[model samples]
Target: MVFFPLTHQIPIPNKDIISWIFDDPKYYQDEPMYIDAQTPSHSISLSQARILVKKLIAGFHSAGLQKGDCVCIHSFNDIHYPILVLGIIAAGGVFTGTNPSYTPFELTHHIQTADVRFVVTQPEMVGSVLEVAGTCKIGKERIWVFDVLGEEVPDGLRSWRSLLGVGERGWEGFDDEVMAGDVVAARLFSSGTTGFPKAVDISHRNLVAQHVLTQEINKKPWKQIRLFCLPMFHVAAVPIIHTSVLKAGAPAVIMLRFDLAQYLEATDRFAITEWYMVPPMVIAIVMSPLAKNYSLRSVRNVSIGAAPLSRESQRALKGLLDERAIVTHTLKTTIQRASVASYQIPKQNHKLIDDNGNEITTYDTPGERKPPSLFTTTPNQAPVYIRGPTVIKSYYKNAHATSQTLTPTSSLATGDIVYCSSTSQEWYHIDRKKELIKVRGFQVAPPEIESVLLSHPGILDAAVIGVKIRGEECPRAYVVRRPGRQWEALGEKEVRRWCEVRLARLGRF
Candidate 1:
């Protein structure tokens, strides 16, 4: 009982990501493509972006970057982030990104798992990155400081600009279908069912397919000005900011970090027509007093994803927008597109199965949803799997992890539980089959936090779980005190303070 897309399949372009972007005439305009929200003057037009990307491609090649080599960017969102991503792929290197807030321990895991050969980081993050680089055996020569806003590089450190060659080197575009489908463009880390971050290999074909399918389904006649407040490292932001926005000829306002006041001001200042956000940001807008201070009348379309937004919250958020504005809820996984409207996407199909590995054809019945595959699985609140062109074929350098998640026919085990409504023929999300916790929009694995907590001498045993806190999912921890009287003095406040310094903001319990 495989459910196919309601829409017809569209032809996906067979070209490298860079070639697909540059070859499109729609993206050839001189208008601003990426604008720094804080410093409006610092913006890059399409032509300027192309030249910078070309320079980066040449730079990467000069720096001994070879095909399939991985280069990591550990920095806050910037106007030039997209440029760096494109440059890496254009040069036949795999681009990976890390959370800017990651501590040395977390950064070490990312660097080692991705096999990062080169690192581009902000001056402020250079210390931690360097520390992690040393732990990962990456040399100082391969690490560069990226002053995204200012031209002055920190003393005694090479700037990312130094990688740029004097002239652009010609990029050999991929015309072969097999090459385009197999070439890995990016390696984004995701905590799958294993509750440990594993590198997911996103091929050039996945990028192109997603870009095409998204554009085909969403046909907007008006020019779109998009606000990018979501972290660039997340899977949700990568395809949209780097590929879709560029191909759609939209102007994106880049925010270094999510400051509510600044976000509202930018929306008003830029007259942002379309943007993507998570549920917590939506909740903030609806509940915050500052939301009324700025003008959000210009925003007409808002897409919320990463976590589920309640119907009540969705309705409340719409009141803050223009009268004609519509709020769309999407559910996107790291490996595949799991939107409620995914049935409209071309070449996509989904199905539902019960615990006995039987397909559930009856609508309104909750079952573990999976993409139709030759493999059988008996499993969540009932796990939803999806098969599509955008789904990754494997996990980078992790054949065991890949084997556990992907079926022989390439259907991805999404680890999401959902049910389809009989009347509307739409999917509804219930819960996750995986142990990963969704805080705001970020994925926080319990094992990662539990490991940190176990390191404390005061605690004998620790367990972490997700709990609904004020309309958002937050991590809650339970611990057992050690037998020693010295451990009795360890208070919750002290433990929390210790964890704050060691863990990322989202991972802190």
Candidate 2:
């Protein structure tokens, strides 16, 4: 008999994201639901956000954008971002977030790949966005600015606030007719160790499944005043901040951009009860001398994800912060719709594969640590493969990529090497599949960088590899110049500048 892990019988909420965000009529719709820590007075209530979302929906519909259309947001995280995202999904449009740091060339690829119908951006980024818009043929009228800081709006573009319809004339309720199984709610770009970034199609079912799983695992009821600092475009930020945190009706501070000093000050100032950070932030906390000055005693829980945290770092972090603070390590994959697959294991959903490509299912002896390709023939060692409801349905518009990733039975090849204890049934991570590079908690594909380098006219043959610089992983490139070109002609600084202009921020070494 095949063994399967049983999950807690939690009630899974199957509906559009708006319903979950505004579920409880009495769920604390107070003055400060989302706050800008830099400017305290700039905050919005849940009621206010709801009204804005309704107006936003009416605006999009009036502007000729229909259900299933793609709307791209190119800006930093703030109170308005979540409202815009939920509003897009609420209006039945697919929401896509472009990295705020991307250049015109890099931004163009995302806009073209997603077939974005409209764009919402901040004033500072309008120049590059306009350059891409010209290339992609997106009309200037379709572009709008938001989160403006008294900056003069460009001549042809409109403000996000201006898109609002009068008195919510075309507004509907929080409810929508989208089904759980179909309709991609969010499209996230993940460079899976090779090629250009592929769009991960996260369905309504996947988001709801994640919400249910998080609710079961985190049984604590709204004690922590949380902070959202991670890039809104990444898989890690959306589920934790948008879905799970909102479901709990907890108050949160949304940072427009992450500054290390500001992060520390905010923790001390707001008496932040919970710290949700990636490994890079935790590493900074452990290493920085400034960490000693702050009063972080109010923090009761610390959660780290988007990359692995070593046992040594975990121990150091625990000692640095309150030793009593509960620090938890979470695993999130972009292909999994930002779901907690490792935490929500349903038993038969996981499998271990050896070097020889054999499935391990049983244990013959106790304490037998055989390094047979490190494959646990006895359910103890090897790479992990996972299948679950929260796993994405497919890579949007890429059937070939989808077929390669999803197995015959729909299990996602996680490419994470792991092991399971026979008696305890606890899964332990050993190493990654040697293809991905985690730079400051973001995935960097070697092939993606290699392709960029190859595109540079000065380069002929190039190979890229991940190098560990100061405890964090960074991509290092080795290049061969063209036949007639010398190393002096194409200097290292020039090549580096070439890469900086073309590659995305995370893709840079």
Candidate 3:
């Protein structure tokens, strides 16, 4: 069973990302929306950000940068990152971000993969960037330093200020030839847990459409104060949080790096009302003793992304915070496919099949022995194919991957499995196709067992992996105790009994 929220709809503009975000007259000249919490002075107002974007674009044009070019951002979180990203988009260029922790070799792979024509990074990353630039045949002149306060431009390099378009206070937008549907926005890579990462081509239309869709699900509040500490490279960070802050004209409090102490401090200091974080961070906060010392009562809602959150953790989070505080699980269709499929599995154009390839009509009835997967469909009864302006054209230059992932009509098989409740039609995402565990002739999802384990009061975090014991494959769990808990008091036997009480017959250890 699948259901989508029936929220009020809003008009999504058919224009470049620059115009789409800043075009809102109400947001224009608004006070500093993007706040660098670490350095309050560095925060950018909407009007200031727009001016910087125009200057950056004008500078790019003056430096002979052309359309369809790519810029790779390799830096930590900062106010300048958005300006740089929007500037690239406004200049009709594709922008890809690099993980700051990436090694020189990993850096080289991403820079070469994205065909990065320009590199914007901080002073600390210059060595790795220079090494990768040497291998990728990129010129140092095209590299600039940002987010490095008061640092003189090193020899043979430039500062971001140098690229600011000096004379263009009121430069016009991108060339008229650039349309909303044009393939010029983001080049995001998958998490690559299964294998090497694949570059996803996200267009301006896909981004704007996703923004509008998000607005329906995440209703705008009267006063918006967003907290962003996730890595900017992830889809949840840049595409979702960045756009959300921009569209809502909210004050985005940013952390240069995620520190639990600083995170708790910020919650109290800012009276942060909105929160977004990954599952591990959620566990860290819930289990941390220091969290109790902070006054986080102002937070009205929290969102978990990047991975699934067990119901146990969700419940615990709500109890730890305000019972009324909304805790939501935000799922992205696929990292490699930068598009919004239904958040919940869609009933229309989605079905489960048995071993004989017969459709599984009722919920809770396990389908045939095939691997598990996820489901979604557009409102028009289409198979959630990669249609619309927001869908990517293809994986950058990888024809085989592109062919296997994208169908002739442009829809993608997300390669995720889901379980549905027969009566309520509520979709429960199972595991990835490749990660499904076959135990005693029954398919068991790791997340399912992990969810059950996390429900135990003693356990804070848990991961389930399939292991062979006595020539029989069974589920093995690695568990983390809540902070300050003694393991001896709650041993393996207690853990097994906890699982024994909750999981179904075949799912037990």
Candidate 4:
């Protein structure tokens, strides 16, 4: 049985991403749109951002950036990062971002795989980027420093500001629906189930659909002040920071990186109404004592992604916030499809199959999630799959990987296990199919045991992994004890007993 979104379908515009975002100038007032969390004074209003984007588009054209060319940003998040992203798309260039902490070897792989034509990086990382670019046969002329604060450029390199053209030769909008669907807007690298990274091609239509669907699902009457702590390079951050915030006409406070103290301070300082975070950060906010000092009362909504959060952690997170605050979980895939509030987006269908390759008709039964298609012979607990306007069409320059993942019906496998509820029509993520462990003919999920371990007051953090013992697979747990004199009395036997009572026989480590 295939499940569809409970929500009604909403029409998406066929215009390019830039035109869709900057649809009406009157929508934005004189208020700033993007603000720096560290230095609140450093901000960009929507009007100012549009002017900068137009100038950058002309500059990109001057620098020989043609339609379908790829431009890579290899740096941390800045206040003006959104401008650069919009500029690239407005210039008919695909925008791709690199992990700021990547090594030279990884950087070279991204540049080659994504077919990056130009690179924009920080002044501090210019030397390493140039070295990696040289190995890929990219010259210094194609490299520019992304100095947003008017900082001095490197000795042999030019600042991104220098690329701004004087006149207004901005992007001529794409009104044709066919061209919007065919044009690639961004090439994001995602290491799905397979450890190797592949460049996922996201088109203009996908961006517009994502924006429209997200807005349709989450309709807020109050003003939203979002705090972004996740890295902008991740696919999850692209739609939120780059598109959704702009579409809502909301102000977003940007953080270059996650720091517990700084994050807490920002929450209090900005009265942040919305948040986009990962499981680790949620755990930190709940387990760290520093959270007690700051005020999280201002946070009205929190969305957790990247990984699943334990029910215990979710409860603790809610306790720290206002009584009316809503904490929602988001399921994200590298293909760029997502589900908010456990409700699937309109025009998307999800299928669940059991271990014997039979479709699971009853809700509340565990099954390996797959995209709806005619083909039925899939590996047990195969990757989760999705087919929709928001999903990517294919992986860039890698036909073999694309063929292995995308089904004949054009659905992309996502490599995750999930179960649906009959009453609420909500989907719950179980675990990564590849990460499930078999113990005495029973399959066990590590997250289940980890969640139980985390509930113990004595434990601060925990991780569970499978280990082979006496030719039988067994689960092993590594737990970090909370630091204190009282917690020191807690021993291994105590932790084991806690799990013995809370977990099933196969789940106990």
Candidate 5:
């Protein structure tokens, strides 16, 4: 992992980014937080969404959300946020949103991390927790909800309606009493390539500086046009769409998810100027029929991170998009919204050098080991530094993990091992720096899978690994059945049932 302070080398406190959004009163009109061609176009804008967010803060306050309180949000990118997060910072609460796909155990892990007293969820995800909450730590009564499928909130649950319209109530100052270097936003439960999943805390400064950095470094002028598939959840998105794009007053055509047809339609529909995509997303874009059918007249570039793209994908991408549109790599610090940095991949690193001609030797590598030159010393684990804008600060309430991942000086010890070409000094990334399994695209920390397996009555010791099937990969665990245990007597087809009951599709083999 590169040791330079990815965040502000000078530490700053965590605070709401609402000031960025609410600053311009004139532009605060209701627009579209979500624009989908799928239906009538479910939408919310900066103005109205924040209004509800403001109300939620009020309701939370009236119901008593003091400083340092943790409020969990579980929803996909609907038309509600840009403001929902703004309100969380404004309310003096730490907003921790969980992946909707989490099992009850994973959900509980984060709840305990943030000490979350209350939860806001959609109906479909409710059963996972409620079925197990009594045995867990979360306070079930504190859940307030949004209707799933437009249905009513379940009995004994609070509706999101009761939490809103705090506009009539005078706005209060932000919750969390933030200070420079203080923990601001919590994106809990990340599993580095080597360890168990833990929460990640991001500071306010970490969030903002990178937003500005993206604008400066990526050559993204607020005035230029931008077209992108939705990567709404990360903090990097904040700097661009929420901060730079919105502030630049540029029109951003959005996609509900990565769809080749939708992405192409969006470019043509909006005359998109740039593309912010992950590798897989780019791959899909390249393979999609739209790549040929649509003329991206205004499309300029495609920015990507996470796993590195092979030379083959890079060549194919430039050929598919306009050749002039550059394909660049994004290095985002691992956090809620990570700090994003960009670098061009060298067909051969030998050609590039610094002003001194000594060579810019900081290279990113393939797995958990640190790039040879980046580390001051050696490390205990592997790190996978992803590409993007906003990087994480620390793991939420996971001091050990935070300490394990983020050093006191602010070098995010990404467990990902990177490699720098000795000849050119440029960086190239490989896979996870650790033993974590990549079931689908998401990381499934091996230790976590092992722990769950051991917890089951049917299992004993277990080891998990990502096994390749045909050419694709999936997880296949190695097991040592309980001594003298009979699979037939258990009457089960598979002894891996423990993992089956707990892991999501992403974690399953």
Candidate 6:
């Protein structure tokens, strides 16, 4: 049962891995599939997918992207992102993604910090690349554009397709001598709420484990469709993309972005079997008037994670789906607060700490450490260990972070709280270590809301929170509007409602 024995005492074998889906080997054999976005999309069969990825690896090599090199992958939910990632890994370069919403300055910081040498983005997004071009080590000439605007390659930037097309035969050398331990895959960013985002270093071993483990969990080998709306920048779904889909060999009905009406329409159109989401996306589908309009017979599983799923939202989601639908969630796991060594539920929700500086033993008491299969630090000392193939090794370029984030032996500190079931030996997520509201289950960082509020001509500053009413949480904003000019026109209720509508992209209120 001991897969990899390291110093932390926590072991990662097939059993401890978190992917709970079932798989079928037939699907992984490489068949034609689609990554849908609007009316147009990219298609790749197993043979096609493999070839494209290897070509990218070859292309990257040709372009001087090699092992230990860093590349920032920033794109919408294109079918090509995964292929690009595989290519990056195949090329032995560090592969990380950026939040499409990141500011030019934020993008530049990560680029420099990660020492990224290449930038891959969509045509429209090239502007953002241009915004930070001067600040990054990689220049415009090195900037590569994807098929974001159909076939229209951006001027001044090279085409990603061209890179792969010319190097079609070069990538076959992947398995020849590349050791399994080589660091390859990556997902960048922090707890998605804490301090600055860091580059998560995932290796070939990490990804293969992810693929196998996810295949085992999903009960594969059946005809099913895997639906993904979230961007790959988020690691919560990283395992699913690499492991589940690869193993299942199922076709994906990908959405470049989320829209309630479009989502409902697509759900009815594709009859998606596996749907992945955060709470906000779930609530929007359930709460939208369009919810009642779909014939989503194919959707058997609703996967939610990356944030707390409100009991209210959970019920609402259930109400929207078929009565037979199953809701499976991997809770938002985090490290216990750094300030207190004993694992305590945030906001004083649990009291497991004792006066003697030790953990308390009791039934369901707060502040008590819940032995977790997964553990990661936000800024804590203890190392995190989870039984998942998708776990990353350390932060890129920051030795201080790498040393601090990893145990003396190297178990990762997930920074998200997790509770291991004593009876089940299964890990259950508890809560986040930072403050971020879930507007319809989507993450609404206070800073994002504050920035949005301040954008209004009459607003100065704002703070936001999830206010639960009868156990249902929604975003409530506190704002200081520009010094008084007729408060009635910008009534709090009106503005609040407006904010709700405006902020739906962040998450449904």
Give the per-residue lDDT digits (tens) of candidate 1, residues 14-58.
Answer: 888888887765655788889999888889887887788889878
Q: How close is candidate 2 to the true structure, as a TM-score?
A: 0.80
Prediction 3 global C-alpha lDDT: 0.69
Predict model 6's lDDT versus the native: 0.58
**Candidate 6, 25-87: lDDT as tens digits:** 465454646566465345666567667766786788778776678777878787777777767
Q: State which candidate, 3 or 6, has the greater TM-score.
A: 3
Best by TM-score: 4
The lDDT, on a scale of 0 to 1, for candidate 2 is: 0.73
Q: Which has the higher TM-score value, candidate number 1 or candidate number 6?
A: 1
Candidate 3 TM-score, C-alpha based: 0.85
Q: Is candidate 3 or 5 superior in lDDT?
A: 3
Off by over 4 Å in 5: 1-16, 24-34, 37-42, 137-141, 166-180, 216-255, 335-341, 344-393, 416-509
Between prediction 1 and prediction 5, the one with superior lDDT is 1
lDDT of 5 by residue, 132-164 (tens): 556555665667776634777778877666767
What are the lDDT scores of the predictions, listed in order?
A: 0.78, 0.73, 0.69, 0.81, 0.55, 0.58
Give RMSD to native, each candidate: 10.2, 10.2, 5.1, 4.1, 12.3, 10.4
TM-score for each model: 0.81, 0.80, 0.85, 0.92, 0.66, 0.69
Show where candidate 1 strays beyond 4 Å. Answer: 5-7, 151-155, 337-343, 365-381, 435-509
lDDT of 4 by residue, 219-331 (tens): 87556999997888789888889876777788999999999999999999999999889998998888788999999999999989877678888999999999999898666
Candidate closest to the true structure, highest lDDT: 4
Worst 10 residues of 3 by lDDT: 374-383
